[model samples]
Target: MKYTSLFTVLLVLMTACGWSQNDKQNTKMNKLTDFEEYVILNKGTERPNTGLYNNHFEGGTYVCRKCEAPLYNSEDKFESHCGWPSFDDEINGAVKRKTDADGRRTEILCANCDAHLGHVFIGERLTAKNTRHCVNSVSMKFVPSLNGKEQKVVLAGGDFKGLQFFLAQIPGIVRTKAGFVGTGSEKPTYESVQSGEGNYVMAVEILYAPEKIAFDDVIRIFMEVHDPTTPNQQGTDMGSQYRSVIYYNTEAQKETAQEVIQELEAKDVKVTTTLEELPSFVEAAENYQDYYFRSAEGPKNHSYTKRF
Candidate 1:
């Protein structure tokens, strides 16, 4: 009851259909069973060691069962013998902690969906990190490790920060970063990219798990959130750097982009998004990565990201 108040439930319910809880990350919430609702929505606890992941150690990620947002990695998982899945860390900004209703212990919830995970205990020295994320297995869904199975895609749609801010929220995404691709400039700075340096569009490199989310789905979402119909422009930003594009890694990916374009055509939506091979990519400044998440006010184009 500390976190799952009636008003909170209604608020989450309204945003369940689409991302936009104050314009943050978005993941479609899944329908919960009675017991799942009891533990997650009602803040009930599962019996110790009875959860599946208590003694389970598999190389993969543990995502929130309700909304499927990445929570903890298997590498962070360890045996605390406390009758629950124990982790020393939660994926960056993926989990939020709050005081329990009893004013005794701290509770952890999915930052994306506010689903109850469990409690956190500190100073126990269970590990060198001196932290324990005692989470319920029923609150998580294990995604098998995709280390060797990693897939990547690069896209440019207006602001490098805005595009990444949206794509990073999708499920199974490992990383997203701003970068320069195909501009032919040996060194391209933000100023250079903004000048549309040598026609090299500013882009965001995305690494993801295909088994968890398909390649085509990513393309569709890219088109949904930005104006693919606009040429060399996104919102107020104008230049080649802001052009909409899909840097395809394979023929299949290229074809997928084409199919998405064709579908838009069917809807009378004239999409100008181009598909090109990914010859190379150069990482931009560190500050450009996860820019929106780092700031409360976000970027100048924050309103555009709220579209989808």
Candidate 2:
């Protein structure tokens, strides 16, 4: 009888330990199954918590946790009280929408991947269009860098022909005879600047100029070669890095730009070119030093013409 009682006690202790281990595991899984980690791991779906996240006033960019793709910018985000982070518009082309399984609702997916994030609804008075994207917080991670002070600069280079072609691709740059001051030549000009080490000289500014190119012609070429329509901005290049301004050496150059504007208006084309009288032209950084000749293989299929 004593032996039987000892055996029973041992069996009961073993069962209790096993149950405890199982309970611990269940608790771990419950904690790890949050929405953000779930999207990062399983790429699963998350429902919008309309009450908790609907009126979120936080300012941050929402990024995909799985692939770290930037999904929404803070400026476009709004409070909809719809139970998720709401945005009137997505960053240019970050999020894509599709028909959901229920056939009555539209599903939202990450632009980088077709990961099902949540649903988008229309006819809500929360935003301009009454459209709200109810997203699950678990599918996203907040990134402060989106609204931080880190500005992006893009440096691009190509031949004179390539530059002309790139400008043509932009909607604003156009050819006009009214802005033409004199006969312009198509001969190329080369400018050389000393390197930082001063050991080797770098050739920059491979530009096309006419034999008797006037000051107005130079201004016209600068405007046509780059986007002057955007104030202190350029295509794919932002901030002051891509600004369009004339580097002038004399008062005559400034007068020529002003005259060209008058002539452009006379020809019925609105002129928005910026002219600045510069003391001297300084050599850009080595990386930004000579872009055109260095990147000859990049975007060279375009053609350049001297006439409007």
Candidate 3:
């Protein structure tokens, strides 16, 4: 009996020690770059529009850089145009909100590792969820979806800056890029196109998930957001490049555009929005991209061109 009791105690101790070692290894922190450490440990905020995930919208899981803890799902991310990665929701139990002395902002952190993310804002009305998790891209690493296949649509609705502002509010849109398209030149640039050298229309290319939103819905939203009736004129910017047009990539998209235009004309709205095959899409100069999203001072609810 003495020997049996001794053996049982030894077994328990061995198992307990083994479990502790395993736990320590499991919680090992990943090596972070200097920028990451600055944001995650020091609680520093990355510059607006500078974070990799700010304009990034891929099907993936965002995990903490420190401990690889799952923090957010890509589907919850939206284009707040606030120059940071905005997520309406986080993985349950993955994120915890904490209040600091300056209670004006709610700080979000990785619940598992307690790594500092960015601030959380409520009542933004930017998304139906009404919550925004403005996070620094360096604080989290993305694990892309295995079966994800992103799709896109391009539409020119006068100033892409104004168009992007409205479209970014939509729930399922993954990302929006301001660019020039429909130009015949080999290389189209913002300066050249804006100068009417290429006659390229300033357009916004939208990337979206098919499962979350339908293509027809994108077309409808495009029509509703901008004055499709005005030819080559969105707000005050008027030129051949500003003319409203849709660059379709497939027959289905073309047909969908036709249907939307027909529906608009049925309501006595003379539509001048033209349809053309997808052409060379050159993203505008870096400074011109995300014109409104790169800052928080612009029109929040509507396009800046609303007055004109």
Candidate 4:
């Protein structure tokens, strides 16, 4: 009878140990879901400050750590000063807000299971839309393959459309039309006519009609090619000789140009791109026309190659 009692106690102790191990494993598995899984299990690195600088991502919603409940979408994720994942808003019925344990602030939790996630703050001015939900990176997971992995930098000539077929073979370039409308002619005019003065004259003119290209595309291409980070110049050409300028027609074009300049400035570029709202432009003389083609074969045998 004593032997039987000893066996029973031994069996109970062994079962308890097994159960404890299983419980610990289950807890770990629960934590290793989504982006958090990548960070923890796969040893992935999370970008500092919730990876806000990595804005190329486009799809999927982030979910909770304790339970796989959906929380915030990619669109809602924006830059916040707090060094964690931040959401401008959360999906409806997905999260519950309650006072935190410290009793000093409100905290957010998984709505379905009441798992503690992070804190949500109101009335922050990071974006035009006001509100921020600061979340710990360990508390959430990003869905698989929804984020953008391909990174590309595009550079376009101002007159890409009229020369589309010619430009297509150049890698990383997509030919799109851009126009200088109203009274201005789509050609370069020789001004402050310094004959042997400036460094290489990069006289660029947009040849396509206005209907073909959007204003935004032009701004994007211009920003891509030249270092807007530099003020008032490009490459070796110094002074106003290689000055970047946008010649606009209507008031709308003017406004768009200003907005583009402002956006570039926000990206920390020291931009000195000149804006010329002009009445008209006169074409350059015929002798200087098609200069690039002629120069490609002769004494000025310098070929212009496209960089993707």
Candidate 4 Cα misplacement greater than 4 A, ranges:
1-58, 144-308
What is the Cα-based lDDT of residue 299 in candidate 1?
52
Considering only N, C-alpha and C atoms within 3 Å, which residue pairs clash in candidate 1? 49-83, 183-200
Model 3 clashes, total count: 2
Clashes of each: 2, 7, 2, 3
lDDT by residue (tens digit), candidate 1, 158-229 = 888877766665555555668888756368877777876675778888876777667877777777667888
Where's the lowest-lDDT run of ten residues in candidate 2? 5-14
Better of 1 and 4 by lDDT: 1
- Lowest lDDT 10-residue stretch of candidate 4: 5-14
Model 3 agreement with the true structure over 1-308: per-residue lDDT tens digits: 00110000000000011111224345646555556667788888877765556666657788876777789998999888888888999999989998944877899988877789998999989999999999987677666563455578898987777677667655456666788886573677777776777657888888766775688877777777787877877667678888889898889999988987887788888989889998678777644554543333353323422211
Candidate 2 lDDT score relative to the true structure:
0.41
lDDT by candidate, in order shown? 0.73, 0.41, 0.70, 0.44
Give the runs in model 1 whose Cα sits over 4 Å from its true position: 1-146, 302-308
Checking candidate 4 for backbone clashes, the offending pairs are 34-141, 35-141, 35-142
Candidates 1 and 2 compared by lDDT, better number: 1
TM-score of model number 4: 0.33
In model 3, pairs of residues that clash are 81-293, 232-243
lDDT (Cα, tens digit) per residue for candidate 4, span 1-308 = 00110000000000011111232234222423345445433334454432321221334567654455688787887756566667878899888899876798778876765556577888778876687887655555454231232221222222212122222212222122222222322243333322223232233343322332356545554555454444434444344434456666557877877887787778776766767665443334422322221121211211232211
Could you arrange the candidates by TM-score from highest to lowest?
3, 1, 2, 4
Using TM-score, give the best candidate's number: 3
